[model samples]
Target: MTGWRIRDYHADDVDGILRLWEQMLAVNADPVYGLSDVLASCAKDHAVVAVVGDEVVGAAIGRAAHAQGWVVFLATAAHVNGTSIGSSMLAALESRMAAVGISKLSALMPAAAQARVGAFLQQGFALKQDLHYFERHIPVQREELKILAELGGRVLPRGLWDGVGGMNAEKDLLERRVVMPLAQSELADRFGVVPPRAIVLFGPPGTGKTTFAKAIASRLEWSFVEVFPSRLASHPGGLAGALRESFTRISELEHAVVFIDEVEEIASHRQGEPPSPTQGVTNELLKIIPAFREQPGRLLVCATNFIRALDAAFLRHGRFDYVIPIGLPDEQARWAIWERYIPDAAVDIDVRLLVEMTEGFSPADIEYAARKASQSALENAVSSGAEDPEGPFIEDYVAAISATRATVSAEVAKEFREDIETVGRL
Candidate 1:
């Protein structure tokens, strides 16, 4: 009565096929088809399915060659049990085989499914005897292989340090404090008798520590590994495993730069309180850092907002040898920062004046000033009802400069500078 419709196999049919296969195996003691075999057959063949409305009541799996007969998977839903569905599905397959000039038909069925095999035999098909199946056990090197269990599957693109506005002194400090030792073979040999020192970049918020870390990595043409502290705390025991996997992956690259941003979040010491979940994570990192340092061609750069809060042990000589402070951008650097922000804007404004005005401002502060200045220019153009409203004038910038205040207070900058000067003598 043509109650069922048959069509070629679609990729969407895989879940249905697998569910049916599993259901049939549960109903009957034996299953003629299995998930792996079905998948393998689909990989090698042009499969087809028999559908009654939206549901797959039956399926035919087979592969064809030029002269030889085709081997096919014939299966039907267990719910439609013993309704000649299997026979009909096999007949449809046989017709396709005959159209392809195949002289015989064959399939792999369990020895216990003799009734099903006899049904196929009745359809003018015979089992060939000469095929012998064998399996081999090939041991893979566990040490050399990397099985990355995605603790967190979200992939962020490796951040490039190209857009940082201005931090010349910080950049210069990093180049001397971190990059130079690693770049020179003699210096590396003289310093440790083996490897270069690991440097830590510490500063207050918005001081461009992460940006500086990326710049050092980029300048050295090293592979960069950016680790977010939050991600490290996501899993309970996964931090160590993830770190090991990451280290293994990084080792493949000749020169790798591993950057830990906001390092204090993970490695900071807990004072006047009990240890929390993240306390264990920092301890694990402390253990790994030494091993990481032992490995050649690897540079570890850690950035943090609060350096004083970090574990005293973590800041010791072997692990994070140098603690380079990334303070507020200096006066000349602020001027350069201003120039960067107002690239094409026509301004008779003195850069030194802008820099002096931004005395206690960080690099981020200077950039914000530039943005505010540009916005002021646009507002002035609009208010004046100028013919070309797009152009920002010098007066707009001067007004913007006059309006904004320094981000860091003079008292705070002086106190910080005093602390640095006192610490420098030690």
Candidate 2:
């Protein structure tokens, strides 16, 4: 308690610092800054130690950025005069850092270290009340940035899931089956629930399959990379080789949602005596899936308008966790779609009537019709030399509905229902 001296840290003080750090951890379950960070700062930043005859008893570490200074670590052995020792070490650290024009000194002491508060308060440090610490851990790390750029992938912004309008049924299914497990992976593992690594989104053309894929990525805050089969066709290694290379690069990413739209083109049934032209590409993809599943923190979303045309082996249980149906929008879904396209200025528009007329319309069909209605109305307004600030009227919408052809036929809708019953896993 009596023979303690405080001075600037030296290279030999590392062992003394380690001893104090381990002693603090033995008592407190949590320490804000990691041992590595504290040790690194001790070597490169401002630091001081209190020793009893060359045996270290206390230490204070700090760093300054701009005018603000942070007390990264403060600790003293139990046998020493802790409060007096801590205050002395802190004062020494402040003096060492004072040369850099530091205006304010702060300590991020965790709740477990409340006993050490006396040292800070005694050094004229005020305890901040009603203040919360907020931090966002970025999903992509620095090393993965180059790989993501090469793959033309990016982390999508938030709110896309809500912006999807309706399709609540599809959204609900994906949220529970795909998103919940992956987002809460630890909890899922506790319950022995394995998150889906890959899934097939199947439906008739223009049912927003691609939209759902991107929204899933956005919802999970993972990087999105869409692999285009047509683009890969021109690769010098050929489509199969290009497909293999793309996935190999994808493996380097820590977290990603890889999308392949119109997958039927590359994954069609491999049959016939001479073997189909895309058979090699299909074989390459089949091999890729098993390897992709082995790696964690990745999801493969393959969308196909013609699910029936896909190879039977590709849809097996181990390869894809779910085979979901993204069919035409139902009543509620159609209403949401109309709501999305309707301009805020078009207050007089009849949404109910428009929804009724757009039944059996694919989401793409609804969007196309809405755009056409606005265009026709614009032409009418301009040609007549009159301005209608209220955008398109209900009549304009009705006319557009009549003119627009549904992307999905009645027959296609019936088949999709049948496919869901037979092939759907969810």
Models, CA RMSD each:
20.4, 16.4
Query: Which runs in model 1 stand beyond 4 Å of their true positions?
Result: 1-168, 186-195, 236-245, 271-274, 382-385, 389-391, 402-405, 410-415, 418-426
lDDT for residue 307 in candidate 1, whole number 0-100: 65
TM-score of 2: 0.70
lDDT of 1: 0.63
lDDT of 1 by residue, 1-426 (tens): 247777877888888788767765765536444568677777666577778787887787766665454444566775564335665566666555545545445566655444455446544344555431111111111221222122221112222444455676666666565677666758777777444547777666677777787776655545466766666545455765566666656555456677888888778884545766567667778888888887877788887666667777777776766667777887767777778888565546666777777777777777777788787777777788978556455565666677777666766566556646533211
Residue-by-residue lDDT tens digits, candidate 2, 241-325 = 9999999999988899999999999999998878765998999999999999999999999999999999999999899999999
Candidate 1 lDDT score at position 361: 76
Total backbone clashes of candidate 2, pairs 3 or more residues apart or in separate chains: 0
Full-model lDDT for every candidate: 0.63, 0.87
